[model samples]
Target: MCIAYLLMARKNSFLWLLLLSLICTLEYIVYMGAKPAGDFSASAIHIDMLQQVFGSSRASISLVRSYKRSFNGFVAKLTEEEMQQMKGMDGVVSIFPNEKKQLHTRGVLDSGIWPESDSFDDEGFGPPPSKWIGTCQGFSNFTCNNKIIGAKYYRSSGQFRQEDFQSPRDSEGHGTHTASTAAGGLVSMASLMGFGLGTARGGVPSARIAVYKICWSDGCFGADILAAFDDAIADGIQLPLELFHGNEKTDTNISFCCNDGPVLASITNFSPWSLSVAASTIDRDFFTKVQLGDSNVFEGVSINTFELNDMYPLIYGGDARILQQVLVEQI
Candidate 1:
């Protein structure tokens, strides 16, 4: 049986940047011929082919990223005329714009991450699976442990912001949240400002995490996403994704969707190869004790991290506003 996989970026998604034909220069990803035979480096071959097409000096400028890991392709900045020329070249498969895609808060892919987070502890866990052949690509002040087996970042079609870290250390907490949710170790008594306090853990607490920093301050570019995908496939991670479109009720095999908002037709996954997961609500309620001067105590839903040493005057919001106006008039 023959199987074909198509990689497409969603509309307005961070995955790609759509450029108009009227633009003098635009970014595009070109998929070359099949993988080279034994001992042949796909990257080297891609560079050579690029040099042949765009000349030695221009090739260096035009070439943005090389996809050699599992897929045989490369991303380049080319004009419309040059794109046409590349289309007629030998061993060229297909070419398309590096469009952008929208991003959701619940999924993975974000700015760099914090390795020191407690959820990323690698205690009592065995070494990574023997099939894992990935490596940790860390820079100064950044390192990966057994819990985070691999780390890599990509930026091919866009420029990084001033605050953007080139390394895989997440400045924002989104990457950490998604990674921890995927494979973070169990963290006891975890809560946000003493809310929902309980034993916190990920779906697969024992599983290791491999951080791939594709999204940046601006957004996640298609070329970068493709580069990360290629590297991931080469790094021994298998993402058997296939796209399908139909009614969910009729299509029983369409199993994958994100932890998106509770809305109609919000399930994002359509492929049968992917998995369906939902973030269920817990039964826990957080309440703090409120003690009055009369020694009367009551429990209210709130987050109280600090102790109240003394009782304070409590008044309605409207009354407090009126009092503030009166005091301002006297002043």
Candidate 2:
């Protein structure tokens, strides 16, 4: 699957992912007509349609999630034959394979944040911006501070692993890293193994973070992502700059940065009113030295800052798995 990580400076980032139709076992997004009105909920209508198309037994097994709040749609695992049948079905707008996108280390307003992380400390922060109007919806073991102004989670499938947190608390570090990188607070002497030593900070350290947890262990689902976009827009957060082509300057408030690796058409995060950023080369690099027990030394490019003073056994990647299994058995 392709996962895109976005970083917005002082404002909300507007990113768009292009979906491609391909033959695979991957899940597909089944878009439908506008949400149904009246007492019949959109989710119920979607289920009913699925039952009619695939019958009750098959629909129950194939249906993954239903989109109700923002639009009318559902995600499911469908075969080519089933997809064809769905196309001919009434109320179905379009169906496309949930294509994969590459993920950037920088995160969008996604995942859940680790509120206890040092990067999210609110020691010197003031109240949220005057225009801020968001709320915290953490269920358990999750809280928001001035720095992380808001939090929310979505799981349309109503399924989660035993390890998954039911709240906006990050069990995996990905969300915390991305959230901090976008607008994290200042952290002094922060380094991994004493590397990259400095006061670690984000692009806009003063900006508040509002998280929308849409990803989980099964990977990010298309339905959840769309739901996040819907809520983010409703929360008065400015997103996506729909620009065709121009040399004109954009607004001073919204800043944009993205990689040029992907084709321009594939990336829809363009705006005539926002300045688009281009990548630049770093001024310096860090090198690491590895000293073997045999008194031989090897040098490589790395950000390692920790000083090694003792000799230790080196293990190969393949052997590490066996070692882990042995350790687990012992425990």
Candidate 3:
């Protein structure tokens, strides 16, 4: 009887140990399953590290300011000497002709048809031999003459969604032209002819651009412009450290539209800091002649008429005028 009792005791002990082991294994699996997937903390840490290394701290700001002061002083001295020389010379009518620094506010057309080398394979379109379509103003041939610096972001299947806004890339080159006119680094025929050189040199030369490729390939949807504005504002805030140098002033100019219609009401309501500009060809009427022209002639077309087929009338002409008037009043 004693031996049988010992055997039962040992059997019970073994069964208890097995059950505990099973429970521990199940608990571990459940704990692992409940954990989140990707570790965002790691990425955040890297970003912080980058901000520390290459980013401008207060020290960098001081250095930049000192340098700018010295450079400006030198330029001022030279200008003073020039003025003195002119004063001594005869038949010098005046030294200063108002010397007005023209202020230009820029805008973006939220078109969808931006070309990308990566999308070529996805769409079965095949990659172009070279990425650049042409050069505009500054830098070397290889650097400047290529397509827009950040065309990759504008391709189809990018972050832009149709539900958000409907415009894509530039099919009509209107967006590109508008962008170039606003903040393009390159000089075109207009600049060479002294047309848009001074007052038309855009609001900011070195402003960082954040594009929202919401427009369709052919045309733009007003909703897309609104989405672009929202996205741009969000992106600007999220990566403020990455987007602009700490020492440099943030660009307040927001250029959009082509030439001369009323600013988008939604844009004005949302991004008050941004200045919306409509295309202003040398035409007689407000709602007519949306095509880009050089010195009052349609750029590519030989025929000249106030044709609705060629023009982009404001979506709501009355609304556009009201918005334009409001923007004017604000200025």
Candidate 4:
């Protein structure tokens, strides 16, 4: 079977030249899949592939840069035998030589904790490609302009609010916030509830937007998420940057509805921090206390209402004084 892969030349030209002079001169571009058959994430696929092929984590440190947003492929450097072995892997689609090409053209491509009034009119600011079909100003009916490339919403379950079913338009403010921060047009003399009064513009005022309303206030189901991913890939979404939470094990245990069966959204232990954080309703708070050799003390966020009347002995590192052999905790 013919497997697919994407290979890219390293960014630094000098490094490439050094390799050509001292190391192997031959270079090949390889394309490999990241997304799995089920609603499983490309992250999960990458974790599985790395463990199966590489002997250690360091092996992947400088070699592979998996494109998570694209969810379909990654760029890596491999020899003929390694490339041939990749083709036999379960998720491997195809592998071939890199078709090198270059073009000289003037082109461009961001806001705030999301600052809305920022100027995107500077260099590298422009509309998206005309072929893009994303939406703008909240999901609406058939809306794609030069500035707004594409728009779509995925709804697998009818359990959402009645209004949500009407249009992919953002019923919740989150979708709008995300869009505006990335590509909202410059609005002169803008303010938030009469605060931060000034020009309110997105990071890239000229950049066009493609709205994909996949989440909701209540919650997003697994099937709907998969549907959204399918549509996004088909509609030419290049990358996704959503974060994933961590647990003791790499496997996330989160399940996704797939055509064949339900698959777990397994990720590695070293996955990056997750952006999708939710607040908890616990009553307890944590605090930290530290003591220095200079008799200086540091206190952290103290949530407990009670105070201790007794004082405890402390120790400091590098003081070379074990008078009472007192131990000190710096946490």
Candidate 5:
């Protein structure tokens, strides 16, 4: 009887382990499918400046016509009739009103002034993964851990100041690039039918963008970076924790930084809504030699890659076609 009972117990344990493995595999598949294959970082849109440069014809028409304007104040709110009219115009695909919410901005600071060697706590913020708490340069240690989020630097007022909440704008183009990559207007493949097939679009083009000029022109910051994150969290968008994995030999030589492990934990503990993303480049040489290393752990998260240039054109140019392809392929 004892022997029979032992055999039965072993059989049950094996069955349970098999079930768990199956469940994990299914969950991974679902996660991979849901992940977007594009970037969704923030970008700056100086409507006023753009309007001045391009004039009201294309600028105003696109903003008003596209219904993509979302700043403090400017043109009077459009009425339902006006909205209808704009939607009916040529080349018009869809228009969405910008809703006010807490805004999140990201940027890099001047590494020379701020120094990547500075500690994290000194900069007045904990790493994304609170567990990795200690001290390290600004928040780059933490920021680098999660490539999805940009780095933070120490700011001492001036153009990068967070007090005014307006003006200066993101001149560096980093913020604007990020925003466009996240969500920009989609371009039609019909325009490219003859040029072979090239579909490029943002991860979430419909999402409204609010740029907070926080980083320096060269990229560096401190409080402003935290403010941006705080604002984003308060704005009600989900924020994902950062995850870091560092090699002891490599990381030791580095000054400020957090590993993916800590960032992921922080995202899980702090923000509940935002999802985390890991950067994956398509360059076989660069990715293989530097980024990928020996670890295949990041395969679980959604991955998106773009050329070093502005991701907006690609996103705005081919969003619709990509969506269509995805749907058709799924079907």
Candidate 6:
């Protein structure tokens, strides 16, 4: 009998073992497709019949949950062999073990300040799935439409000003820009200032947006990251997790940065589930500048040519040092 169950599990599904408990005597959660009805009395009657098929007691069977007319189904508890038998019953549609689901820690979005427009080959794909809920406040003009299916925010420390930080309404444009890059509607002749003007669109123009504002100007908190991740998974954002590709690897073409502290791989590196995207360059010549006291100026390399060139005093790394050594240093 043990071998029979093992063979059945192996042949049936990868999910079979996932959903079923290892113990032979433990209860299994089965999803049974139910009959349509104005009232659920018919489904209840089937449940009663299903109960009697076993031992007609709570010890034998129990309905964990039942779906309404919209989705005809029920989740029930039964032993492994009984669940197998339940699959063979006259009105039974399908049965499988229910298992716990987890969220991948990281998800990647392709690099860019974002393009004027991104074109994709979506020959076989259908329209985007709308599977999330929004948390936009009614009093605010910030809205969530069909294309933008979800909006959410998380803040573990209630330190920010209530006016600007009260809701998912993005004040800094960080959240707004990222959301647009992922699923923005088609815009004609979009550009940065008078530069790079062209038709702007997202990688999936038809795809819906789900916003999770886990950051503020200060920075994102660890607790907020967890909250955003939980909501993203619950909202059914099933796309692969993305992480940094350590662009500053100490080698050719990679002008390594010793300024940003010791090199450490982002969490996206360790997980096999993530797709680590390495940053690369384009043909467009961009400029970077470091200004000194008086008229002295040094130019560096970068794609961002739009720095304000504000007259705020520029100081060397030595000039910015403080007497207090509070930051933790690795010996």
Best by lDDT: 1
Task: Give candidate 1's root-mean-square deviation (CA, Å).
Answer: 10.7
Report the lDDT of model 4 for residue 190: 82
Model 1 stretches with alpha carbons more than 4 Å out: 1-23, 32-57, 84-94, 105-109, 241-331
Query: Could you give the C-alpha RMSD of every candidate to the true structure, in order shown?
Result: 10.7, 12.4, 25.1, 21.4, 28.0, 15.6
Instruction: Show model 2 residue runs off by greater than 4 Å.
Output: 1-28, 32-82, 88-93, 97-106, 123-133, 241-284, 291-296, 302-317
Model 5, position 94, has a per-residue lDDT of: 41
Between candidates 2 and 4, which one is better according to lDDT?
2
Give me the displacement of residue 205 in model 1, in angstroms: 0.9
Ranking by TM-score: 1, 2, 6, 4, 3, 5
TM-score of 4: 0.36
Predicted structure with the largest TM-score when compared to the true one: 1
The estimated TM-scores of all candidates read: 0.64, 0.62, 0.27, 0.36, 0.26, 0.41
What is each predicted model's overall lDDT from 0 to 1?
Answer: 0.69, 0.68, 0.32, 0.44, 0.33, 0.49
Candidate 1: global Cα-lDDT? 0.69
Residue range 60-105, candidate 3, lDDT tens digits: 2211010010011000111232334434433222233212111122
Candidate 2 lDDT, tens digit per residue, 1-331? 2222111221342212111111223577888745567555666666777677646655555667776644568887665656778888887878978653333342554568889988888988888887777779956577888888888887876789988898888777778888887888889999777666789898898877888887776666666777676677667677542221222354343344554545655443445555655456767677878899787989988775456778878889799999999999999
The candidate, 2 or 6, that scores higher on lDDT is 2
- Model 6 lDDT per residue over 26-145, tens place: 333343433355656635665775666554444223554444422345555566666777777766666655432122212121111111123222334444464444343423545554
Task: Give the C-alpha miss distance for residue 59 in model 1, angstroms.
Answer: 3.4
